[model samples]
Target chain A: MTFFYISAAVALISSVLAISRSNAVHALLYAIVSLLSVALIFFMLGAPFAAALEVVIYAGAIMVLFVFVIMMISSGPGSTQQERRWMNFRLWIGPSVLSAVLIIELFAVISPPREPMSAKPVIESKQVGIALMGPYMLGVELSSLLLTAGLVGAYHLGKRKDDAAQTEDVTIHD
Target chain B: MTSVPAEYGLILAALLFAIGLAGVLARRNIIFILLSIEIMLNAAGLAFISAGSKWGQADGQVMFIFILVMAAAEVSVGLAIVLQLFHRIRTVNSDEANTMRG
Candidate 1:
């Protein structure tokens, strides 16, 4: 229980920091910390399989993709300077207050005493796999289809045009 | 035996989601916006896992796996579009990308 509270707090604080950072790399690093802490929470919740996937896929693969894009764009120091200017108190204060209110409301709604459920067995990876293959087979197949389409779309959208052609296309589009 | 109540797990998820929502509403840079969306998606996954744990069912974990798949596809295609947008506009400020705001 102590570990769960600690990790949950870590996740919340890091997520807040992740979004508020002016530098993209700094924000990405915080996001990674936030993700890892969430994974810890998942582990404590008796969903070890979900926790592992949260680490392997969410923290590893997805974040690396964001890092690669940030690297490729290579926003100079000037960009961070601009970001700093844009991320002022005026811009963030409203959202922060609104979110705080929402959270408080959620806490109120969720904190009411309720009957505790009987203890059940932990969900293992094997059970998850069986569930996926059995009743959720259609979802798995559809996700694969979505992945294929995303791959093709990304490739098409990301491909570079010839330099001269690009200039001409930009002129026409603008 | 799981020690923590399901309500606590849910509260944590709600907190994360709120933070993500604030990020999405506040950030101006497109990358940060996308990152905020990722955080929101993650919070949703956390909620599912917690609910699954409550019932001792594998379904929550299965749903999280699907959420993982959806997030991966979203980031891949989203970044591709971001790259294209940066190439065209030379800037990642969402406010600046309002050329199509007819």
Candidate 2:
């Protein structure tokens, strides 16, 4: 439990710094620490499977590509562009309020149970594999197809550049 | 010693998720934005695992694996596009990339 609290504190601090920091690389490094801390929390909670996935996928794979993209393009913030492009608009206000409500609802749901920790050992990936690939295979397949399409579209969009002035390397879809 | 319960982790998860949202909202750097989204995803994953363990279910673990796979796909393809966008635009700032305005 102490470990969980420590991990939580670390994750919180890093995440806050991840946004507040001006250096883009430093921000990414902070994000990585936050991710690892969350992964540690998963481990302490007895979900070793989620813990492993957290470390491998979020900390390892996704972050590697992020660093790679940063290197290919540039490091740190580009010119002090102060274009106040609706950074404080109503577009996000409504969603944020709704999210806050959802968080409160989650708190209500989780606060009641004070049962002792279960004695069952940690669940492994094999159990998860059976659940996802056996009973829940269809949804997973559709998501995979969706990912493939996204990759192809991104490739197509990114392939037509032969110039040096082109700066952005990834264009997210709407 | 009084230890924090798993429910406290939910609150922590909510806070972390919000921070990620702020990162995605406030930052203009593309790499930072991607990192923010990663934070958001991991936060949700943490909530899932913690809740699942508290409730005694393996479904959460299973969901996390898929989430991991999706994260891998996202970062790979996302970075590839970022690389290409950088190649064509020479800038990674979202505010600057206005090549496709409709």
**Estimated TM-score per prediction?**
0.82, 0.74
Error of 2 at A15 (Å): 1.3
Question: Which ranges of candidate 1 are over 4 A from the true structure?
Answer: A75-120, A163-165, A168-174
Q: Note the B-chain TM-score for every model.
A: 0.95, 0.91
Clash total of candidate 2: 19
Candidate 2 CAPRI level = acceptable
Candidate 2 residues A107-136, lDDT tens each? 542366733223435666777778888888
Query: Which lDDT tens digits does candidate 1 get at residues A85-124?
Result: 6566665553355345434533542366722222445688
Computed on alpha carbons, the lDDT of every model, listed in order, comes to 0.82, 0.69
- Poorest stretch of ten by lDDT in candidate 1 chain B: B93-102
